[model samples]
Target: MSALILKDFYVMWKQTKVLLIIILVFSCLPGAFYPTFAVIYAAILPYSAMAYDERSKWDQLAGMLPYADRDIVLGKYLFGYLSIAVAAGLSLVIQTALTLFWERASDNLSPLSTIPLAVCVGVCVLALTLPLMFRFGVEKGRLVMFLIIFLVCGSTGVLTGISSDSLDGGYYLSLALPAAALAAVVLTAVSIPMSLRMYRRRRA
Candidate 1:
C-alpha cells in the first residue's frame, strides 16, 4: 500500500509541478476560499493519478503484481487523505501568517478552524468520487463527480455565508467543526468498502 501511494505521489509530482506552483501562489493570497480551494484541488490529485493509471492500463499490470485488490483500492484513498492533510497544513500556516503579520487583515479567520472544514470538504469529495472512478473509467467518472462537487460546494458556501452573518463566529465554528469532522469520518468508512468492491469488479 505504501509503495502504491509513493508511486502515485511520484506521478503527481511529475505531472503537477506547475499546478502546485499555482496552488502555492493562491495559498498566499488574501481570501479564505483560496485555502479551501487548495484542499479541494489536493483531494482531486488522486483522480488524476488514476487517469494516468487508466491510460497506461495499470490495473492490468497491477493485477499481475503481488499486491492485493484491497490494498490497490485503499492506496488511492490513503493518498487522497494524505494530500488533503498536507494541503490543509499548508493553508493553516499561511492563514496563521496572515492573521499575525498582514496589517490589513479584516476577517476573523481562525487558522485552526479552517483546517477541519477544509479537510472535511476534501475527504467528503474523495469518498464520493473514488468509487465512481473505480467502477467507471476515470474520464467518465470525472464529469459526474465534478458536477456533484460544484453543486455541493456552491450550496455549502452560501449556507456558510448565511450562518456566519447570522451567528457568532466562534459559536458557529464550535458547532460546525466537529460536525464536519464526524461526517468526513463516517463517509470515509463507508466509501472504502464500496471502492474495494468496485475495483474488484473492474479488475475482474
Candidate 2:
C-alpha cells in the first residue's frame, strides 16, 4: 500500500510540480478564494495520476507486480483524499496567518468563514469527480467532471444567494462543514469498492 502511494506521489512530483506551483500562487489571493487551493488540486491530481497510468499501459505493467487491484484503486483514492486534506489544511494555516497579519496592521479583515466552505467545496468536487474517473477512464470522464463541477458551483451560487439574506455565516458554515465531511467520507468509501470492481472488470 505504501509502495502504491509512493508510486503515485513520484508520478505527481515528476509531472505536476509546475502545475502545483502555478495553482499555489493563486491560493494566496484574498477573500473567499483561499479554499480553491485544496479543491482545485484534489480535483486534478488523481486524473493526472490516471493519465500517467494509461500512458504507461498500467494494465500490462502492473500485472507482473505483487500488488492487487484493490490496492491500486485504493491508493489512487487515498492520494486524492489526502491531497485535498493537505490543501484544506494549508488554507487553514494561511487564513490564520492572514488574520494575525490583519490584526497587527489594523486592517479590515476579510471573514475567515469561507475557509470551511472552501474545504466543503473541495470535498464535494472530489465526491462528484472521483467516481466518474473510476467508472470511465480519466480522459473520457473529464467532460462529465467539468459539467458536474459547473452544476455544483451553480447550485452553490443559487443557494448562497437565497440564504445570504437571512442566515448568519457562522450558522451556515457550522452546518455545511460537517455535512461536507460526512459526504467526503461516504463518497471515499463507496468509490473504493466501485473502483475495485471497475479495475477487476478491466482486468477480466
Candidate 3:
C-alpha cells in the first residue's frame, strides 16, 4: 500500500511545479479576494490528476501488479487528499503574506483573519469534491463538480440573504466549521468503499 501510494506521488510530483505556479498566481491576489478562488482551484487538482492517470492507463497497469482494487482506489484518493492539503497549506501562507503586505502598505497592519477563512473554504471544497471524484470517476465527476459549484454558490447566496449574521465569525467557527468537517469525514469514509467496488466491477 505504501509503495503504491509512493508511486502515485512520484507521478504527481512531475507536475508539482505546475501546481506551484498556479498557487503563486493565486497568491499574488489579495488574501480576502484570493482565498475563495484558491479553494476552488485546489479542489480541481484531484480530479485532474485522477483523469491523467486514467488517460495514461496507469491504473490498469497498477491493477495487473501486486495490488488490489481497494488499494488502488484508496491510494489514489489519499494522494489526491495529500496533494490538496499541501496546496491548501501553501495557499494559506501566500494569503497571509499578501494580507500582511497590504496592511503594511496602508500602515494599518493588524492580524488578518483570512487564514481560518481560507481553511474553511478549503475544507468545504474537499468535502464536496472528494466524494464526487471517488463515486463517479474523474470523467463523470466533472458533472458533479459543476453541480456542486452551482449548489455551493446558490447555498451561500441563500444563507447570506437569509441572515448576514449567520456568517459571523463566532457562528461560522462554532457551527459551519464543525458541520463541514463532519460531512467531509462521512463523505470520505463512504466514498472509499464505493470507489473500491466500482473499480473492482470495472476491472472484472
Candidate 4:
C-alpha cells in the first residue's frame, strides 16, 4: 500500500506542486473562485496521475506484482485525500490570512458555506468518477466524467436559480455543507469496495 502510494506521489510530484501554486494564486482571487479552484484541483489531480499509470500499463504490471486489489484501490483514494488535504489546507490558510488582514473579507465572501461546498463538490465528483475509472480506465471513463460534471453543474445552477432568495441565510452552511460533505465521504467510502470489486474482476 505504501509503495503504491509512493509511486503515485512520485509520478504526481510535479503536477501536485503546480496545482498547489495554482491553489495559492487562486486563493488570492475574489469571489468563490478561491474555494472552487481548490476543489477543482483535488478533482483533477487523481485522473492526471491515472493517466501516467494507464500510459505505462500499470494495471497489467501491477497484476504480476504483489499489490492487492484493495490496496490498489485504497492507494488511489489515499492519493486523492492527500492531494485534497494539501490543497485544502493551503487554501484555508491563505483564506484565513486574507480574512484576518482584511477584516471585512467576510462581507465579500462566504467561507463557511464555500469551504464545505468545495469539499462536497470536489470530493463527491471524484468519488463518483473513480470507480468508473477503475472499471473502464480513465480515457474511457472521461465521457462519464463529462456527463456527471454537466449534470452536477446544471443541477447546481438550477437549484441556485430557484432558491437564490431562500438559500441566503448563513445557516445553509450549517445545514447544507455538512450534508454535502457527509454525502461525499459516504460516496467515497462506498466507492472503495466498488472499485475493488471492479478492479479485481478485471484482473481475474
Candidate 5:
C-alpha cells in the first residue's frame, strides 16, 4: 500500500512544478480568490491524473504488479487528499502574506478568517468530488464535476444570502466550517468503500 502510494505521488510530482507556479500566481492575488482556485484545482488533479492512467491502461499494468484493488483505491484517495492539503497550504501562505502586508496597512481583511474559509472550501471540494469518483470513475467524473460545480455555486449563493441577512461573519464561520468538515468526512468514509468495491468488481 505504501509503495503504491509512493508510486502515485511520484507520478504526481512530475507536474508539481507547474502546480506550484499556479498556486503562486493565485496566492499573490487579493482576497479569497486563490483559495477557490485551490479547491477546484485540488479536486480535479486526481481525477484528471487517474483518467490519464485509465486511458493508458495503467490500471491493467498495475494489476500485473502486486497491488490489490484496495491498495489502488486507497492510494488514489490519499493522493487526492495530499494534493488538496498542499494546495491549501500554498493558499494559506499567500493569505498570510497578504494579511501581514496589505491587511495591516488597510485594516480591510482578517487573517483569522482565512483558515476556516480555506478548510470549508476544501471540504466542499472533497465532498463534491469523492462521491462522483466513487460512482463514475475518472472518465465520467467530468460530468459529475460539472454538476457539483453548479450545485456548489447555487448552494453558496443561497448560504451567502442567508448569512448576510441573519448571521455575522463569525456566526457563519462557526456554523459553516464544522458542517462542511463533517459532511466531507462522512462522504469520504462512505465513498471510499464504494470506490473500493467498484474497483474490485471491475477488476474481477
Candidate 6:
C-alpha cells in the first residue's frame, strides 16, 4: 500500500506539475473560494493517477503482483486523503501568512475556519467519485467526475456568500465543522466498501 501511494505521488510529481502550480496560485488568492478550490483540486490528483494507470493497463499488471484488489482500491483512497490533507494544510498556512503580511488579504477568508470545510468537501468529493472510477474505467468516469467538480465548485459560492458574521466563528467551529466532519466520515465509510466491491468485481 505504501509503495502504491508512493507510485501515485511520483506519477503526480512527474505528470501533474502544471496542476500543482495552479493549486499554488489559487491558494495565494484572497478569498475562501480560491483556497477551497486548491484543496479540492488537489484531492483530484488521485483520479489523474488512476487515468494514467488505466492508459498503461496497470491493473492487468497489478493483478500479477501479490497485492490484493483491496490494496489497490484502498491505496487510491489513502493517496487522495493524504493529498487533501497536505493541500488543506498548505492552503491554511499560506492564507494565514497572506492575511498577516498582505494588506489586501481578506481576514474574512478565515483560513482557520474555511480550511475545515474545504477538507470536508474534498473528502466528500473523493467519496462520491472514487466508486465511479472503480466501477467504470477512468475514461468513462471522467465525465461524471467533471460534473461533480462543477457542482462542488458551484457550491462554494454559497459558502462565500455567507457573511463572516453570520458564520460566527464560534458557531462555525462548534456546529458547522462537526456536521461537515460527520458527513464526510459517513460518506467515506460507505464509499470505501463500495469501491472495494467494485474493484473486485472489475477484477473478476
In terms of TM-score, which candidate is strongest? 6
RMSD of candidate 4 to true structure, Å: 3.2
lDDT tens digits by residue: candidate 2, 1-204: 888778888988888897566546545555443345434445567778888888888857888999887778877767876776676666666656766786642242322455455555655666666666766776677786676557446644533443343346556666766876788678767766776777777667
> Model 4 over residues 145-199: C-alpha lDDT tens digits?
6865674465344333322343564555556767777898799889888988887
Question: Over 4 Å off in model 3, which ranges?
Answer: 2-20, 104-136, 140-142, 148-170
For model 3, residues 1-204, the per-residue Cα lDDT tens digits are 788667666665685657656755765555234444444455556556677787898777886799777777767666656655665676566656655566652331111333334344444555555555656677777788786577545543433332234246445545655665676677667766766666666656
Estimated TM-score for each candidate: 0.89, 0.80, 0.71, 0.82, 0.78, 0.91
Identify the superior model by lDDT, candidate 2 or candidate 5.
2
Root-mean-square deviation per candidate: 2.3, 3.3, 4.4, 3.2, 3.4, 2.0
Residue-pair clashes, model 6: 0
The Cα RMSD in angstroms, rounded to one decimal, for candidate 2 relative to the true structure is: 3.3
Tens digit of per-residue lDDT, candidate 5, span 131-181: 556556777667877875665455444443433343376566677777777
Residue range with the least summed lDDT across 10 consecutive positions in model 1: 158-167
Off by over 4 Å in 1: 110-112, 148-167
Cα-lDDT of candidate 6: 0.81
Instruction: State the C-alpha lDDT per candidate.
Output: 0.76, 0.64, 0.57, 0.69, 0.63, 0.81
lDDT score for residue 162 of model 4 = 29
Model 2 bad stretches (over 4 Å): 103-111, 148-167
Clash list (residue pairs), candidate 3: none
9-52: candidate 6 lDDT, tens digit per residue: 99988988898888889887877678877887787888889989
TM-score of 3: 0.71
Candidate 6 TM-score, true structure as reference: 0.91
What lDDT score is found at residue 104 in candidate 6?
Answer: 76
